[model samples]
Target: MRATPDNGLKIRAQLEREGINVPSLSERTPSANSKSDRKKVIMGAVIFVLENAADALKFVPIPNPDAIPNLLLKWLKVYDTVGGNDDGLKELGNDIRKAYATVLQPLELSEQIPPEVVRLIGGFHSDLEEQINEIELLKSQHLAKRTILAADITKRISGVRTCINNALNSVSTQATILTLLREIEASSQLTLERLPRAAAEHTYVKSKSACRPSTRVKIQKSLLNHLKEAKNRFVWLRGSPEIGKTAISRSIASTLEKEGTLAASFFWDKSRTGVGLDSLEWFPSTLARQLAIFNGDFKASLVKRLRRPDSELILNLLPEEQMKTLVIEPMNRLRGIFSASTQRFGIILDGLDECGDPDALKSLMNLVLLLDGLPSAFVILTWIRLHQTRLLTQSG
Candidate 1:
């Protein structure tokens, strides 16, 4: 039963009369003894049957539901005969069969196929048909041309898979970045909420007063000079009541703040009788909170500390322990970022003598010594009574 051009044309005409439109096969008939031509004929038959099976599913009643599975089995037999030696073609065939079985065949059997499902199947079928036509055309060409076309098709399939993988990875990376940003934001908000502060203690409080211009110039100049050139970290501004020590401290704070080196300031007024401004209970946490607001790097380091399991214990610790944990630890973490800089941060404590507790005042004097050993340069200025100032200067 050798195929001939006249036989192909007669078969096409008969099918056309039956209202079927198969591809013309007159120019594709195989030679009687050519194995390659025989393989081409088998491939064409497989493609034709697959197309008929796909078309049969389009009808509402589906001409013969049982026959469609039989057509698929026959398609696999023909595919194995021609494509078993070509791994790429064999894999493509398996994928097509799986898609049909998994998504279309079951839906068709249920008699509830949606229009979108039909469109999906139609698009998939068209793409497979185009690839099969290309393979058939390549098979008819010279061996070199067939090899080139086969390699090109393999490359295209691999590239499509790679693109899909890259898109998925990009979406995952974006989601990770967004999650990290949200966590950082939440941590920052919590840090601000947990720390206690006295709003009236800041140097910018409207009720506080700075030194009058041209007054106390000699003492102010000497203090500023010592801050700039002295190796000691602590400076004591000592005077009796009504001698303007508080005013001079306020003036120094304003100057350092304007120079962008003021880390924090706290003013204690004994006149605010019932207020806790005369105690050290909220002192360390308040300064730490202000430092966090002053610098971005310090804020990030402080947030890391707040995430620790023991962080909640910081607030309950004594003033000295709180100072070390809340303030010194975060400043130590900034060593790498601050090492190259010579700029000194100024921390002002106005009216330290006004603190009502003797034990707390002594503890604070010891804490000032601890600030001297910190990694970053810091200048601490305190205003106290002349009698109390001698104890710290003598200890230093």
Candidate 2:
């Protein structure tokens, strides 16, 4: 039966009792020939039933309540417009509607339904519509047999009931799976928050200086090309003191930041001595924090690593170990997700020679070399004074 204004008002009142406010159907005129207006009435009725008849329709568990109206409207549109008053099509539509209502009536209450169930229901409706169309075509060609068509209609209605029952049966299993996923996400978020980080080491610090607009153009271009096309991950830029390596590093970081590919940057300054800037103690954790911020997939993998039972000792490990634990492992997990077309992520380490601890500087170089075996898309740029040239030579 077509939904009338009085029926809509009753449905609205019922929904109001359930703490929902739906606009009255009287707000829009209903015309069966007008597709838009007819669909609106169907949508309004479906939404009203879902909101008002929560207890009665508890069998249909819609996890996302907002999605049901559109889904149900799609099924209903098969019978939405009945043209030329074909008696067989009209009777078939009535039988399908009755069968649908009957199927929903006997289902047990549930709290969730998977997308597979929804697709199954949609498939049943499509198959039923196709059968009806085939029968119509046969009738037009004067080849239709009434008994055969009746048997097909009965079988189609049985299939609809079976589809609904199957969907209801699978709800409990799907709900369990969904609950487990949510718990894992919550746990991951907590572990990631517990990861230690240093904020001051970021390249955007006020004391940091980038190259002048007109200067270092050639160096910046070469550095960018190396980042994009070079197979080797580590690029050591060794130069004499006061040659503006830090400035060039900062400028490269800025350019990468604008392009959304800068993973992290750390600059060691001897002038900022007492603030722990000369040590590599916080370096790995700082980069881990920034890498987590850069990409969600990396963050998830890092959180998984941090959730391990022995992960608390990650910060206490040697700098190279810390780099492997926090950076390399998580980046390796992203190999399956990245493609050749994906932009390379830039990492800048400036002035490691200024680090006062020789042991820490040695460990940093080891860590840099270790990073060379990482994904080809990860670019590691290290800047050091000419005096530290022997460290790279010795390590090689």
Candidate 3:
């Protein structure tokens, strides 16, 4: 290329071609070939496009036609129109495309429009966040319910653990729980029982087994015979309070209880501070526990009855019923099982006058004697009432 002055001021570029057919300063036909040169420039651009872009269409199948850039396809079509007639233009087209892409990249926008326009992407994002918030709220509510249920389950587990620990301790503690279970079994034989009176609290009970054998000789002999003889099955004594009656009875009971021949006994004391003598309610049950403990064979029957599903209801039975159910019946059962050889028994019930109603005690006793259909079981009565005396006289 060379620069030349035109009309002394304009600068013009002139081709300096060697061995190429083009007009120059020395050539007189420059204007004559200018139209043909324009055709050559257009044809060169077509060949360059075909060389760079043609193979991209052939080697890579467009998996989604819609994914192709429309501008790229339009440009490819223009290149094919101009260069399709000449295969020599293919390489040049590919080289031009490399340069074309380098220049085009900086002009492209950041993103395409389809997801924003066709898919409602903004709504989808909002819905996702809303769903996440709802799930978090639900989790918080369920956590509270789970905590309450967990606490309840833990409480139940703790109760079971305590019960199991108590059982394990029983093995090392002399089977105290089993003894208590036996006591509970015996307790069922009684109904609304007045607490038992301690023997030491009784005035006539001087801790001796009998009234200084020298003091109550005749009384001792008679009471012993009554107890020893299982034939009579009933012995009624008539006496007054503080007249050596209770002394004899307690002496006899204390001695017999030790010998294991005493079935059951109730020493009445109105001053005893309970319903023990009130209608003799506690009489039967007190005797029952003693009898059940005395005879192992009888425990099975007593425990079986006491352990009934509704065994607590039995505690509400009348005193006479309690005596019949707990004492007389069990004694009779022993006699039945052991036959006539069943051991004779005695119950010392002294100080009847101290009862809330001595007549009630008398009536309940009379009921026992009247209903006396069992082996010999003697009762010693000591009271300070004339009415009871007449009642006893008639009943005895």
lDDT of 3 by residue, 169-265 (tens): 3232433554676687557545323324233223344333446768878778777776677566555566544567777777777677777676556
Model 2 residue 373 CA deviation (Å) reads 2.8
Error of 1 at 343 (Å): 1.3
Show model 1 residue runs off by greater than 4 Å: 1-183, 204-207, 273-276, 393-396
Per-residue lDDT tens digits for candidate 1, residues 184-235, read: 7876978666878765445544565788879889888888777765385777
Superposed model 3: Cα runs more than 4 Å off: 1-210, 275-279, 376-386, 393-396
* Residue lDDT tens for model 2, 317-373: 878888899888888987867656467888888878766677678777877787775
Cα-based lDDT at residue 344, candidate 2: 85
RMSD of each: 18.7, 10.3, 40.2
Overall lDDT per candidate, in order of appearance: 0.62, 0.63, 0.46
TM-score: the better of candidates 2 and 3: 2
- Of candidates 2 and 1, the better by lDDT: 2
TM-score of each: 0.52, 0.54, 0.44
Winning candidate number (TM-score): 2
Better of 1 and 3 by lDDT: 1
Of 1 and 2, which scores higher on TM-score? 2
Task: List the pairs of residues colliding in candidate 3.
Answer: 48-93, 51-90, 51-93, 51-94, 52-93, 52-94, 233-376
